[model samples]
Target chain A: MSDSRVSSVIQEWASPFPGQAHTMHPVTSGQAESTGQLAQMEMMPYGQSQLMMREGGEDRVAEQMMGMSYLSYSSSCIGNAPSAASTNHHHQSHGNNEQDFSHFLLPTLRAPLTKRSLSKDSAEYRLRRERNNVAVRKSRDKARRRIQLTQQRAMQLQEENQKLQMRIGQLTQELDTLKHILSQRHMPGSEEGAAGESRI
Target chain B: MSDSRVSSVIQEWASPFPGQAHTMHPVTSGQAESTGQLAQMEMMPYGQSQLMMREGGEDRVAEQMMGMSYLSYSSSCIGNAPSAASTNHHHQSHGNNEQDFSHFLLPTLRAPLTKRSLSKDSAEYRLRRERNNVAVRKSRDKARRRIQLTQQRAMQLQEENQKLQMRIGQLTQELDTLKHILSQRHMPGSEEGAAGESRI
Candidate 1:
C-alpha cells in the first residue's frame, strides 16, 4: 500500500476545507447583503488592509479578519433592530429556540468564512470593512481619553483658582492689620503705644 | 480781659506754635540721621513720592501709600531680624519693658523720617522704599499664584496620563483576546467547532 505517513498528511489537508466552509455557513451571502450598515462600514478611517503585506501575501490574516467580522456581524445582527428589522423578521417568528441555534452556529460560521480566505471583490470589501471597524474603535478610544484629560485639567485649574483667591484674602487682611498698627503709632496715641511696646 | 469768646481764640492762636514746636520736638535733625536705614530705604524701587502725579498732586494717595508702607514696615521690622537686627538691637536688649517705650516712640522714629512729607530728601526716600516694598509683595503674590496654576495643570495632565494608561491596558487585553480567538480558528481541531455551533 501507499505510505501510511503520506496518507495521514492527505487526510489532514482534506478535512480542513470543509471545517472552514462550515464556519462561514451562518451569514450566507444573503444575510450580509441585507444589512444596510455593513457596506457603509467599509469606509472606516484606518486606511486599508491592503497595506498589511503579510509574508507570502498571505490570505491567512484576511481569512482571520473575515471570521472575526462575520462573527461580530451575526452577533450584531441578532441584537440590532434599527436595520435588521426587515431582514430578520422571519428569524424573529421562530422564537427563542431559533436564537439558540443562531448563537450555536457562531463558531462553525467562522470556519467556513476563513476557509474561503480573502478572495473575490465582495470578500476583499468585507475584509476592509472589518479592518476599518477595528481602526475606528481604537481611534474613538484615543479621543475618549483626550476628553477625559481636558475635563480633569479643568477641575484642577478650578482648585488652584480657589486657593489663589484665598491667599489674596489673607494678604489683604495682613496689609490692613499692618496699616492699623502703623497708624496708631503715627497718631496722637504714641504714648499708649510706647507703653504697650514696653509690655512686649 | 476781652469777652470770653475772643479771649479763647487768642489763647488758642497763642498756644498753637508751642504745640507745633512740641510736636516737632521729637525729631530734631539728629535722630533721623542716626538710623542709617531711613536714608537707605528711600532709595527703594518706587522712585520716591516725587513721581506721585494723581489729581491734586494730592499726596493723599502718596500719604496713604506712605501710611500703608510705614505700617507694613514697622510691623515687618518688629519681629524681623534681617534689617532690624542692627537698628533695633538696642530696643531688643531693653528686656521687653523699655521696648514698650521704644514701641510708643515708633511714631517718633518715623516722624523724623516722614515729617518732611516727601519734601526733604530723606522723606522722599522713605516713601519710595515703602512703595517698592508693596510692589514687590504684590509681584511675589502674582508669581505664587502663577506657580500654583502651573503645578495644578501638571497634576491634571498626570491624572489623565494614568487614566489613559489604564484604558490602554484594557484595550490591549481586548485585542489579545480577539487575536487568540482568531488564532484558534486558524489552527487545527476545528471539527469540535462545527459540532458546537450545530448544538445551538
Candidate 2:
C-alpha cells in the first residue's frame, strides 16, 4: 500500500513478464493444464494486484515491495487455501518470480469488501459495529477528566479573592476612627489640650 | 506565593527596622488630645506597617519606603477625610515618615481577595460556580470523543479481519475444485498417448 512498495512491485512485474514468455518450456500436459488454470485466476482483472509506483530509489522501492508482497501472499495463502494450488501454478507460469505473483495477489487481498461482504452475516460488518461502540466509550471518559481539572482551579481562585476583600474592610474601619480623632483636635481650644500637652 | 517572592520578603523583615524612635513633641492642646487618641489606636496594634530593610541598600529601600508611605497616607486621608488634620499631624509626629508607613501597608492592601468575596455575595459566587460547571461539561465532551474515536478504529480493524477471513474461505473453495480437476485428469487412460509413452 505504500507508494515505494507498489512501485517496486510494478518494476518486478514489468521486468519479468517478457522474460517469462521467452523461457516457457512445455510442462507435462496435466501440470500444464493446472498451471493454465492458475494463470487464469491470477489474470482475473478485479482480483489482480496493480502496483502504482512513485519516483524513488529502486533499491528502497524493491525492499518495500518485497515485504508487502510476502505479507500479501502469506495472507492470501492462509485466507484462500482452496486456491493455493492454482495460485502457486500461476506463480510458476509467471517464471518463478515470487515478487510478481505476490504483487499481483496483494492488492486483491487488501481491497475493500464488496456490498455482499458488508451485508448481514458477514464477519467484517459485525466487527465494525463493535469497534464503533468502543470508540464512543473512550471519548466520553477523556472529556470528563478535562472538565474536572478546570472546575477545581476556578474554585481555588474564587476563595483567594474573598480573603483579600475582608482585609481591606478592616483597614478601612481603622482609618475612619483615625480621621474622627483628627477632626476633634482641629476644633477650638478645649480641655483635651491640657491633657494632651502633659502627655507630650 | 512563589518561593522567590516569599524568600525575599522574609529577608527584608529579618533585617534591621528603619526610622527614628517615637519622640514626644510639643503641640497645641487640641492637637495633643488628638495625638493621644492616635497613640491609643496605634498601641492597639491595628496592623501597623512594619519596616523591613536589607543591608547596604539604604537609598533604594528609602526611596521605595517613601513612595509606599505616601500612598498609604494619601489613601488613609481619603478614607478619613473628616480628620485629615489629625492624621497629617500624626504622620508628621512619626518623623513624617509617611514613606515608611506606606511601604508597610502596600503589601497588605495588595493581597488578593476574590475568593472571599465570592462566598459573601451569591451573585458573584454563582458566576464563578457556573464557570466551573462549564469545565465539567467540557471534560465530559472530551471523554465522549475519545470513546467514539476508539470505537471507530476497533470497528475498522474488525471489518478488515472479517474480509481477510472471507477471502480465506474463497481460496479454500477454489483449492478444493482444483484438486478435483487434478484428480480427474490423473484417472487411468485419460490421455491415451501420454499413458502409452509412460508405459513404454
Candidate 3:
C-alpha cells in the first residue's frame, strides 16, 4: 500500500527485530511502495508448522517436534509392538549417541495407542485407557495454552517493537524540523535582520 | 481459562518476553508467572487474534496486522463530516509544530465525506466526488492490509518466542538427564560396567 499508515507497517518489519541490529546488514532503501511489498514477502510464513488447527495448536507443534525428534523411535516401534526386538534395534541404531530420550518415549507412545489387542478391551485395560486419555487431554491442553502464551509473548514483542519504531519516527521528525528552523534562521536576509535587531 | 491450554496461554503471557533475562532476577519464578499473567491480560487481544487456526497459515497474520492499524485511524475519521470548523480547530489545536502530517491527511479524509450542500450537487462536483469515493476505497483497503500486517507481525513474534522456549525446555531436560546419568556412573561401581564393553 502506498498509504502512509500501510507504509509504516511495512517499514517497521523491514527493519530488524529489536536488538538484532548487528545482524541486519542495512540495504539501500526502496521507494515507499516497493518497500511495503518487500516486507510482506519477507514476513510471510514460508512453511511454518501447519498445525492442523482443527486438531489443536500447541499439541500439534509438540507432536511435530516430538515426532521429528523421535521419528526413528516412533517409526521403529510402530510395528514392533514395543517388543524387546524394537528396543534392541533402537539402541543398536543409536549406538553412539548417549540419548535415551526414545527409551522414555517408546513406552509412552505405545501405551496409549494400546494396539487394538483383545486384552486392551478388558475393564482393567479400559480403566487404564481412560486414565491415559485424561492425561493425554491434560497434556494437550497444557500444550495448547503454552502455544497461546508463546503467541502472546510474540504479541508483546511486536507491541514493544511498534512503540519503539513510533518513537524513532517521532524523533527523526523532530530532528528534521529543528534542522529546518536552524537553516532558516541562518539564511542571509535573516542574518541581516538579526544584526539590525542587535544594533537597535 | 485454567484449562491447561488456556492457562498456558495465560502463563506464556505472564512470563516476560524472553531475554529480559536480567530482571528475571529469579525470585522463585511464581511472581514472574503472575507478571506473565498481567502481560497476558494486555496481550489477550493478541491471543484472540491467534484464532487456533491451522489452515492457510501466515497470510492470516499479515491480514490481521493490516486490519487493526487501519481500524483505529479509519474509525476515528469516519462520519464526523469533515467540516471547515473541524479542520480549523484541528489546525489551531496543532499550533506551530512546523509539521503538517495532517495537511496530507486532510484531503484524503474529506473527499469521501463530500458535504451535502447544494454547491456539491453540481455535475463537476459530483464527478469529483465519485473519484474521491474510489480513492477512499483504495486507501481504506490499503489501510486495512497494513493493520493486518502489524497483527501478523505480532503473531509471528509470538510463534518465535514459543519455539525458543520449547528448545530451552528440551535442552534443560537433556542437561538434567545427563546429570542423572553422570551421577549414576560415579556412584562407584557403574563405571566398570560401562567401560567393560559397549554392552549398553
Question: Which candidate leads the pack in lDDT?
Answer: 3
DockQ, each predicted model = 0.00, 0.00, 0.02
lDDT of 2 by residue, B52-149 (tens): 22112111000000111111112221121111111111222323322322335555463223322322123444455445544553454443333343
In CAPRI terms, model 3 is classed as incorrect
Best by TM-score: 3
Q: What tens digits encode model 1's per-residue C-alpha lDDT throughout B1-200?
A: 01011111122222323332211111111112111111121121322223221111100110110001000111112221111111211111223232123335666463333222321123333345445644653454443333344345556665655565565555444434433443454466763321121110
Q: Pick the candidate with the highest DockQ.
A: 3
Rank list by TM-score: 3, 1, 2
lDDT of 3 by residue, A5-99 (tens): 11112222222232322211111111111112323332333333433322212221110000011111122222221111121111123323332
lDDT (tens digit, per residue) of candidate 2 on A1-200: 11111111122222323332222222111111111111111111221222222111111000000011111121122121111111211111223222322334455563222222222223443455435533543343333333332333334444444454454444444333433433444466562421221110
Q: Model 2: how far is A69 from its true place, Å? A: 70
In order of lDDT, best first, we have 3, 1, 2
Q: Which stretches of candidate 1 lie over 4 Å from their true place?
A: A1-200, B1-121, B191-200
Please estimate how well model 2 matches the true structure, expressed as its whole-model Cα lDDT. Answer: 0.27
Candidate 3 per-residue lDDT, tens place, B70-134, comes to 00111111122111111111112223333323435566453333332212223433455445644
True contacts kept of each: 0.00, 0.00, 0.03
Report every candidate's CA lDDT: 0.29, 0.27, 0.31
